[model samples]
Target: MRINSLPLRVRLTLLMAMILSIACFSLMAALIYTARIVYVAPQLVPKVSTSEEMGREPLPVTIPSVPPIPSAPPIPSVPPVLIEQQINFASTGFLCVILIIASGSVLTYRVAGGALKPVTDLSKEIEEIDENNLYRQVQVPPSKDEVSRLSISFNRMIRKLEKSFTAHKHFTANAAHELKTPIAAMLARIEVVQLGGPPSLEEYKEALQDTQCNAERLNILVHDLLRMNADLNVAACVTFSAKELFQSILSELAAEVQSKDIDIEVHLEDIPVYGERNLLHRAFSNILHNAIKYNKPNGSIQITGTRHPDTTRITIADTGIGIPEDQTDKIFEPFYCVDKSRSRELGGNGLGLSITKAVIDKHSGSIQVQSAMGMGTTFEVQLPNASTVY
Candidate 1:
């Protein structure tokens, strides 16, 4: 089998076993060589006599006459006991090497398993988590190492996913509710007209008008919902003048402004911005539309624009019935309205600000609102300056 196909623990144990086996065999060879030098080599090599002993030996000996004797059988070069000892040493060394390698392999396998236990546990914990149990967190090992860090990162990811899932659920429910209201209204009205047989021209006209209004509301709701989820096309973006854009919006809403007799004040520095012009226009128009719709009669609306080194900021402040402090943060949620009855009266589906926020985010810009109860509200928008960004 391929080495990689083996489990990590097995691979580690094998590697360690290889190293231990090599070391044991090398040690055995060295011990055998040392034994040969100390025992066997000495027996094989004849010793030389010293010069003084050789010089003095001839004077002390006297020759005696004797009969000649046959030489005994030639002595063996290596003694039998020495050969047996050498064989015994070789056999013992081989057995010791084998014993050491076997024990070392067992120890290495256990050590590898202990080292990998944390990782195995973490994997099992993660496997048990699914969408239904996203809230469940993996046990972070106390050993402040890579395994602990991995657990922490996974927990963070799970938290973010859970939050996103919850928000998605809320959005789906709100969208359905918003869609159902208009459809129900139209259906109720059509049913009434249908049940009333042989109705007069005036009654029919009234019913038709009511149905048409509900249908229009449904159409706008669907359009804004689609816009909120739509992906912007970066290729279609271009730089445009912020002042001119506001002027165009104001001009389009001139009739409402005239009827409300709301004074319009414009003090702008023709700040250039980089983004999709149509999207930017819609975002600014939504804010302005809310200001007009919610403002008190004859309330003054002030529009101002300032250019910073890297950003362009525009603020539209109006003398409108201000939003409650607690609900200000939630004003941009889809289908969320501060004053539901008033919003319906003004023909709003509560998606205008949501769409505005989506558009601003697409342009890498930010929008904020500041308001006090019974006081006026102001919306501030900041976008990247074309000159600086390009």
Candidate 2:
């Protein structure tokens, strides 16, 4: 097989085995060489006495004539080399090396597989996850190893992605539903006017007014949708005074405040907040407008701003028909209206709070609502202070 085509475990095993084989082969060769020097070399040389001088003359001695001495037994000669020993050793060492290579490669393969089991499991789990199976999570190993930690982080990232995808689908469906209403209204009104041939000035005026109103609503909704989706580059974000922001929002909605005959009270302190000014302004406008739109005639509304070293809080409280306790948690969801009929009467598209929440989220801030049925509702927004931002 091609080396590159092998699995990581197999590749690692083969590489490790090759390294160990090279080392073992060198060690075996050294052992054989040492055996030849210690055992085989000694037999190749005759044992010569140092006392016998090669060039020295033999001493003259009186010789006995023809004396015959009987020897009990003759000494056997020792073999200079053991070819069988060398052959046995060489064969054994070669067999041992082959055995080691075979067993070691298999053992290393097992070890590698054990180490990579988590990766295999993670891959399988990821492959199984899709839109229908987004809730599936990779099984986390109990051991606090790198593999286990990596799996945990992958699961965390997948969970975040799943949530984002789900929200996107929901947002898309809600936008379609919201846009459908205004467009349908305009179409219906035009069809009606066309069916009624050449109407009177009053009738034409009313029909035109309704159509124009629906068209304007459609335009506003489209603008808000675009704004919500448009990426706000954080590099352009800056700190602006919270005090001035609220005052400006109040001034902009002064006509609405006056028409409702609502009492507006403000207690604000100069404070800097970190965010995109336009998005923050939009968020603040939504909250303040909701307070006004839902306020009781001749009722009271309170706007308070406080600053801390790390955070700033803005509270918009109004004495209006409050949201139900059970539904408070879902009020921030896109196109989730507490009172659908009442919301339609007030021309509320239900995207206001969704946009506000998105803005706050973009700034890493939070918004919460406090309310009870028939009692007043309070929306409190908390933003990171400019001083606390990096």
Candidate 1 is scored at a TM of 0.74
TM-score of 2: 0.71
Instruction: Name model 1 segments beyond 4 Å from true.
Output: 1-6, 11-105, 386-390
List lDDT for all candidates, in order. 0.88, 0.86
Q: Stretches of candidate 2 above 4 Å error?
A: 1-5, 15-19, 22-91, 110-166, 233-236, 259-262, 296-300, 370-376, 385-390
For residues 1-390, what per-residue lDDT tens digits would candidate 2 score against the true structure?
799998999899989899989988998999999998898777666556543466666667677897779775544344534777887898899899989999999999999998998888878888988878777878888999988998889889888988888878987898898889888988898788889888888888988899898889989999887776777678878978777888899899999999999998888766677889989999989988888898889989998888877898888899998888999988888888888888989889888998999889878899999998778899999998666767
Span of ten consecutive residues with least summed lDDT in model 2: 72-81
Question: Could you say which candidate leads in lDDT?
Answer: 1
lDDT for model 1 comes to 0.88
lDDT of 2: 0.86
Give the clashing pairs for model 2: none
What is the Cα root-mean-square deviation between model 1 and the actual structure?
Answer: 8.3
lDDT of candidate 1 over 174-291, digit per residue (tens): 8899889989998898899889888889988998999898888888888888888888788877878778888999999999999899998988776777788888888889999999
